[model samples]
Target chain A: MSDTPAGGGAGTRRRGRPPRTESADTRDRILVAAREEFSEHGYEKTSVRGIAKAAGVDSALVHHYFGTKEQIFEAAIAVAFAPTLNAPAAIADGPLDGVGERLTRFIFGIWENPTTRKPLLAIVRSAVNNETAAAVFRRLVAAQLLRRLAEQLGHPDGELRAELAAAQLVGCAMLRYVIKLEPLASADLEQIVARIAPVVQGHLTGP
Target chain B: MSDTPAGGGAGTRRRGRPPRTESADTRDRILVAAREEFSEHGYEKTSVRGIAKAAGVDSALVHHYFGTKEQIFEAAIAVAFAPTLNAPAAIADGPLDGVGERLTRFIFGIWENPTTRKPLLAIVRSAVNNETAAAVFRRLVAAQLLRRLAEQLGHPDGELRAELAAAQLVGCAMLRYVIKLEPLASADLEQIVARIAPVVQGHLTGP
Candidate 1:
């Protein structure tokens, strides 16, 4: 709560205290507003003031919760991609064969979900347009997530193979969701899985 | 050139009309400028005036050469992707087995060249950010180019297969060029060709 400090400290307290949950609630609201603003206007145009207005908070509170715009944008990407960020761990470690299917199912399933799709789309669109957003996106996706998957394979060229696999899915997302290219855009999910899964499997385990 | 276009009627021209090649050169310069502006500022923020300024021409000339910003954007896409737009013909009426190799070689070959890479990057980036740009990009890539490749394959789910193949390549382009992700970006073109050609071949000719 804004009014209460974890420990009694000078310049940390106010007369009235709000619940800890209330502070989290405010943070969530600001994050939601930030996502919307970033998605719509992208990184360059979005400002803390605009997000604060949208969240019905003072600009100072946005800075308090998230130190800077870059920090806020990073937080937004983390939240949006949180569903898939843990995906490398989702694949059961064993035979290398079906990693592709599990990976595709998890990644595409998140995109297919209406609730997650909205924020993911915003983050993607923002990343594509803004260099700062793209840098953060690249680090999360390439450095953190896919590279981890590559390491799990324990194969030579694991990183390259992992990236190629990622490329296929990212490309699929770019078309099916972002650009909404036809056929792929309208293709049945099972059909997509059937068609693409082997190719992914090949990338992961192929010589 | 600027003087000649203003009040010329019935073949009456100004004192030293630029050569036909000069006119073509001017048009090419404008296209280059449009690509840069669109890529940098995106479709919504990029203006004909900005493009003209970048090209060192009057805004009126941009309108004259390419009526609207949309038309200019379309022209930019055409110029940028021209190498790959006709790629189905480049593969010849060969066995489906190597069609993937030929296609990959042709598609990635364009990106490898510094000349074409600039505009292609612009179009790809703009498409990722702007809906209108994406629509135009989708039509050019899907309807004009890729769908035709699918038709040539004459396989059941030919379009789907074609798009899957495209997704592989497009995804590679996104990572290697646009996002510049890790080893893929710096990987030898031949190495990329060796690695991805089979996956593309699989998507195209695989049962």
Candidate 2:
């Protein structure tokens, strides 16, 4: 299983047009390698060389794809956190008053999406185990998600309340996805959002 | 720093008939060691031997102290979580229907105590990074803390609501302690709890 191909043989059987430099593919390969390395060995322990080796690509290719390890990590984080970050916008772009309903629906919708949730779990796991990774997680969550939410609220303590709301949301995620707490683990996403959204909305919009 | 005396020479200067083998103290030391180890390395990487080494005792002594790594971890968790676990009881035991205020005061008070907060932060950080640690965290938080709060509420969804409130409180702790977000990083405890507790109480006992 360790020797299993990382990306499946689909890459090997390319027949049409030789794929125009394969930069995007190589970048993705490096990202997958970085995620595995960071998850398994932690951020401090995972190196560019290690990621390159895992990706089965040359070190120069890895560097070419990402300027530095920090860049690679930033990319990994962007991918991992894109769902949550994208949520506020999705909710905001919709009807305004039901922001609570929309936000809750969007947030839980991401958690219910396996493709998004699995990477989130991995990112959360990595953050817990590694300081650098935790820092990355913090930066992404705070800057991209929380700050925007705070800005949207425009209350005097908007930032703090936004963070508090984030804490509640993320904690729910931790319990539901990571811990797999009973009833909650199997609970319907719509039900959860409906139940929890008002509370989150209260934090975001209440006095 | 690594070579510095374990407890700043306090370990060597202890006198008085070898101190009555206070199992609590020994158990406490072992738990503290386990907390640090688990925080730094997560559950899988944190070994009994490593904790023992950090605690300046033999690996056998660790077993004698706590029987097994899991037991040691449980002890550590109990210690780390004692504040939150005990808070519901404290609040319930207090006078009258100010349960929300009492609970909020108790919860914030624990976060303010450095002795408690440090280990709790470690546990939270560990839970984020490791599945077993996360499970242990969930079990303890839900069984010991949230259940008590839920039972006290006696509402239909009291249990779920308690869990939600617990998540909010813990999430606040995560941001204040682990993520160290600004303003919140320096917010007054009384102000925060006062503002947030009513919301929690609403979750606990509302229409």
| Top DockQ prediction, candidate number | 1
List, residue by residue over A14-56, the lDDT tens digit for candidate 2: 5552333356667777888887787666666779999999999
Per-residue lDDT tens digits for candidate 2, residues B24-126, read: 5666677778888876676677899999999877899899878877777878888778767887778888653577778777877877888877777677766
In the predicted model 2, the residue pairs found to clash are A128-B129
B-chain TM-score, every candidate?
Answer: 0.82, 0.81
Give one digit per residue, the lDDT tens place, for model 1 in B1-207.
Answer: 442333445454434654344567689899989878876777888999899999999999999999988999999878878888879889866777889999999999888888878778778778877889989998899888888999888987888888899999999998888777888889888988998999899888887
TM-score for each model: 0.86, 0.84
Give the 10-residue window scoring lowest on summed lDDT in candidate 2 chain A: A1-10
Two-chain complex of model 2, DockQ on C-alpha atoms against the true structure: 0.46
Error of 2 at A36 (Å): 3.5
Model 2 spans > 4 angstroms off: A1-20, A40-42, B1-19, B22-28, B95-97
Give all candidate RMSDs, comma-separated.
5.5, 6.2
Alpha-carbon local distance difference test for all models: 0.85, 0.74
